[model samples]
Target: MNTTSRPGSPAGLRDANRRRVLDAVRGAGAPTQAEIAGVTGLAPATVSNIVRDLAAAGRVEAGDEVRGGRRVRAVRLVRRAGVVAGIDVGHRHVRVALADVADPAGAVDHAAPPERVEVRADLPDDHGVADGLDTASRLLDEVLARTGARRAALRGAVVGLPAPLDLATGAVGASGVLPGWVGVPVAGRVAEHLGVPSWVDNDATLGTLAEQRWGALRGVDDGLFLKLSDGVGAGLVLGGRLYRGPDGTAGEIGHVAVAPGDRFAAVCRCGHRGCLETLVSTRTVTAMLEPLLGAPLTIADVVARAHDGSSGSAPARRVLADTGHHVGVALAGLCTVLTPRRIVVGGELAQAGPLLLAPLHAALEAAAVPGTVRTAEVVTADLAEHAPVLGALALALERCALAP
Candidate 1:
C-alpha cells in the first residue's frame, strides 16, 4: 500500500494543514481554537478536527478557558517523552531550564502540558569554559533528578553564550570581549558531554528569540531585545525572525560609538574608546556612585537604593536615569537604521524600571529622528533573568521538533 500523495492531493493537503495547526499552537504558547484559526487562516471546523486528532494522539491538551468573559476552547502542547534543555551561560552565572518533549507518534497517553523548572548557579568573578561547563552539567543532573528522569532521557540542548558564537564551528567567535572563552568550541563540548543534539547562539540573541516567542516581541515583526548589564548587547528580530547577519553577530550594539567627539580615546575591551558599553554598562554605572558612598557597589545594590524611595537614594536613582539617557542615545542610531517596532530592555540594570526607561525615552526623543523614534516603543522585558534560557529552549524545540 502506497502512503505517499501528491502535493495537491487531499491526503497531502491534510498533512500540510495539520502542520500549520501544530506550528500555530507551538509558537503562540496556548491559544484558543479561534485564535489559532485566525493565525493559520484555517476554518474553525478544520482546525477543530485536526486539534481533536492531535489531542487524541497525545500531542496537545485542549480545554475550555475563559477569555474576555467568554469561554473558548484553548489548546497547548504536552510533553510525552524525554525533556528538552536550555542553558544560559552569562558573564557570572549559568541558568538552566527544562521542559518535556512532545510525543512524535502518539506513543504516550497524556492530557496535560509538561511541567517546566529552572535553576541558576553563580560562578566566580572569572572562570574559564571548563568551570562553566562543569557547573552546567551538575545543574542538569540536579534538575533531571527532580524530574525523575535519567540522564539518558535528555533529548536536546541549546546553549546561550555571552559572546559572539560561530554556529557552524560551535566556537566563541571573538577575543577580548570574552577572554576566557574566546576561540573555545564551547557548544561542541556541551553537545559531546550531553550526548544529545545541541545548538548555540549569543546569549543576547537567544533573549531576542525568547521575546519573540513568549514576551514583549510577540506578534511583532521587527523588534530588538537589549541586555543592559555589566556590558551592553542586543538581539535583533527583523522581518519576524531572529537575524544574526552574515557572521552571526548582528546585534553587538554595545560597541557602537555613542560618546561625543573622538571615538578612539576612551579605552574599551575591544580597544575602542567612547564605545557605548564603556559608559552605560553596570560597572560604569556603579563606578560613578562608589566614590560618593565610599564603598564597593554592585548594580543590584544601586538598583535597590534607587527603589528605596528615600532622600538618601535620590543620587542612586539619578545615576540610573542618566545611564538610561546614554543608552537611549545609542538606541536612537539603532532605531534610525532598523526602524524596529519595539525595543525590550532586559538584564540586571533594567530592574530599575522607569528610573532607567524615562530618561532613556527622553534621550531618544532628543536624539533620534522624530519619525523613527515615534515608530519604536521602548519597554521593559517580561521574562527578566529567565529569558535567555527560555530562548534556548525555544530554539531547541524548533530545531529538533521535540520529536525524539
Candidate 2:
C-alpha cells in the first residue's frame, strides 16, 4: 500500500480528517460525534472512527451526557494536568469550584467542562472578614487534596463577590449588601490563604464572563448578562470583553427605574423609588406573590410551581411573568442606549424559564425602539447557576496566560 502523506492520498485524507475531528473537539459546544461532524463537515461515520482511534490512543476522553432528555456521547481532548479555582461568595452562601485548565497558549480556547473528578463545595456564609477568609482557605486546601492535584499546580484563583468591586480602587461597593466585607481586600485575603495570586470581581460580571466564554452568549461580541437573584444586577460584554466602567459600576442597571409611577413601587436599597431592583429581585417578586398565594413563598417554591404540571401553576407563572415584564421595561431603555445583540437572563428565577422569557419578550417588543427589539434576543442562561464559578475559572486561565 502507498504510504505517501500528500493531501490527496488515502493516508493523508484520514490524517486531515483526524485533525478536523480534534479541532472540532477543541472548539466550543461540539462534544458529540454528530456535533463534531457538523463542525468539521465530515461524515458521522468518519468522525466516529476518528474519535474511536483518538480514545484508543488516549488522546481524548469519551463520556455520556444527558441533553434534552436523551443520552449522548460527549468527547473532549485530553489535557495536561493543571488546576485553577473559582469562588462565588453569595449573600448567604459560598461556593467553590476547582477545574482543570489546559495549556493557555493553545490556539483554540481551552474548554473546562465539569470534570469527572469535579469537586465543588458549599460553605456557610460566615460573618466577619477574618472568619470567611479562614474558612475559604481551609476549603481550597481540602478541594485540592480531594482532586488529587498538587497544590503547586494551582495557577491562580478568582473570587466573585455579590457586591460590586471597583476595578480602579480594588474596593467593594454596595457596602450595605455585604457590610462585613466592606473595606476588606478580598482577593488579597484569598491569595494569602491559597498562597497563589488571586483576582476578584463582581459576581454578576463573572456570570457575564462565563456565559460569553462557554454558554448562551458565546460568539456574540456585544451582549448583556442580567442576573436576577437576591438582587438585580447586570454585566456588559461589549467589544468581546467585559466592559467594567471606570468606577466598575458600568452595569448597575438595577438602580435604574422601571416602574416609576406604579402604585406598587417601593424605595430601593439605593434609596430610589421604582428601581428595577426593587421590582425584579427574588425577594420583591416573591413578596408580590405571597399575598396572592396567601402564604410566603421562596423563589425556589415559585419556580417549582411555575414549571408546568403543578397544581395552580398559573399563579406562580403569572408572578414570574409580571417580574419579567418589569425587567423588559427596564431593558428597553438599556437596549436603546447600548444596543446589545443578546440578553441572557440568569440567576435563581431564570429557572422559571419560559414563564419569564415570554413576558420579557412581549414587553421588549412592545416598548423598545421600533427596530431595537429586532436586533436583540432574550434567552435564559445555559450555564444557569454555575456561571459565576465557571467564569472565575475562565478568568484564572486568562490572567495566567498574561502573567509574566
Candidate 3:
C-alpha cells in the first residue's frame, strides 16, 4: 500500500489534495468514498486510495452499508483510534482535555487547575509561562495515563494561550501584559517537554473554532466569537476558516477604544486608557458593583445576583449592559466588513446569559447596519466556559485528520 507523501515542496500538491479530502469528510461529518471525491474535486480512484491509506493509518474508519442501492461504504473520522491532547492556558487557570481522533463524542478525560502563580498584578510573566507549561504537561500526562492511551499513539497536541501568538514561529507576541512570555516559543517548548507534536493559538481563536464546530455558530460560514472572562477578546471566522490575519492578531478587540479620556481612570494592561477591556473585564465590573452591593463580589457572584434579580443585581446588570454596548460598538465595523451569520459570546461574564446578551443584542441592533443586523444571530456559546479546551481538541483533531 502506498502511503501519503510527507509535506514538502516536491509533494506539496499531493499533501494539499489529501488535506482537502480530509477536510471534506470532517466538514460533512461523514461521507462515502464517492461523496468524498465529489466534495473534494479529486478523482474517485485517488480518493479510494487515500481513504484506504487513511483507514490503515487509523485516521479514518469505514462504516457499514449505503443509504440507497449505491453500495456506499460510509466513512467517518476515526476519533478514538488515536489520542490527541488539548491544553488551554488562561490568565487565571489551566484546563486539559484528552480525546480520540475517531470518535469525538467518546468519553473525554479532562482536568482544570488554578494558575500555578498567585493572581496578582506584580507576578512575573516568566513565572507564569514556565509554571503554566509545567502544569499543562503534568495534566496532559495524567489524563493520558488515566485514559490508558499509549504515548506512541498520540496524534498531536494543541494549546490555547491567553495572549497573541507569532504564528510563523509559534512564539508569544508582544502583549506587554503577559510578562515573561515575550519571546518564548510556547508551542515548540511545550512539544519538547511533552515529546509530542504540538500547536498553539490565541485562546479566543480556539474558542471560536469550538463554537463554530459544536456550539452556537454551528453552520454559519462567517461569525465572531467574543470571550468575556478575566479579559476580553474576539475570534474571527470568515469564509469557513479561522482568520488569524497578518501576524495572528486579527481579533484583538479587547483593546479597541471605548472611552476617550482619563475620566474612567482605568488603565488597561495593553497600556491604553478606556479600552473595551477596562470597562467590561470581570475585574472592572466587580469593582463597580462592590460599592453598590456594599460587599466584595466575584464574577460568578455578580452573575448569580444578576440572574436572581436581587436588589444588588441592578449594578451588575448595568455594568454588563454597558460592556455589551462597547462590544457592539466595536463589532459594528466588523459586521459591516465580515457580515457574519452569527455572533457567539463565551466566557465567565456570559454566564449571566440574558443579562449580558439582551444588552448586547440591543446595542448591536442599534449599532449595526439595519438589514445586516437581521442576517446575524447574536447568542451565547452553547459550550460556555469549555469552549477553549474543546477548541484545542478540535485543533488536535484537525491536525490528525490531515496527518500524512
CA RMSD of each candidate after superposition: 6.9, 10.6, 6.7
Q: Write the per-residue lDDT of candidate 1 for residues 1-404, one digit (tens) a residue.
A: 97665688997798678778877886777898888999999999999998988787667899888889988778988754567889998777898888777632221112222246799898776578888889999999989988888888787899988777787787887776777888888767888888997888888998887777778888899999999976689999889878999989888888887765784557878767788888888878888888875478987788888878766488898898888998998888888888998989998887888999989989988998888878678899987867788788877766554242
The Cα error of candidate 2 at residue 209, in Å, is: 1.3
lDDT of 1 at 310: 65
Model 3 spans with C-alpha error above 4 angstroms: 1-52, 55-80, 104-127, 291-296, 369-371
Write one digit per residue (lDDT tens) for candidate 2, span 179-232: 678878778777887888999998889999888877888889999999888767
TM of each candidate vs. truth:
0.79, 0.73, 0.78
TM-score of 2: 0.73
Clashing pairs in 2: none
- For candidate 2, which ten residues in a row score worst on lDDT? 103-112
TM-score for candidate 3: 0.78
Q: Report lDDT per candidate.
A: 0.80, 0.76, 0.76
Candidate 3, 1-404: lDDT as tens digits:
84645667547676677667666776688788888988988999999888888788777888787566756688887755677778877776788888766554221211221111111122223356778877776777677787777777777889888777889888777666566676788888878887878998899999988887777777678889999887688998888878889889888888887676667657878788878888888777888888887567877898777767889777767787877777788788778777888899898888878777877777877887887777788888888888888888877876765564
Quality of model 2 by C-alpha lDDT: 0.76
Query: What's the distance in Å from true for residue 204, model 2?
Result: 1.5
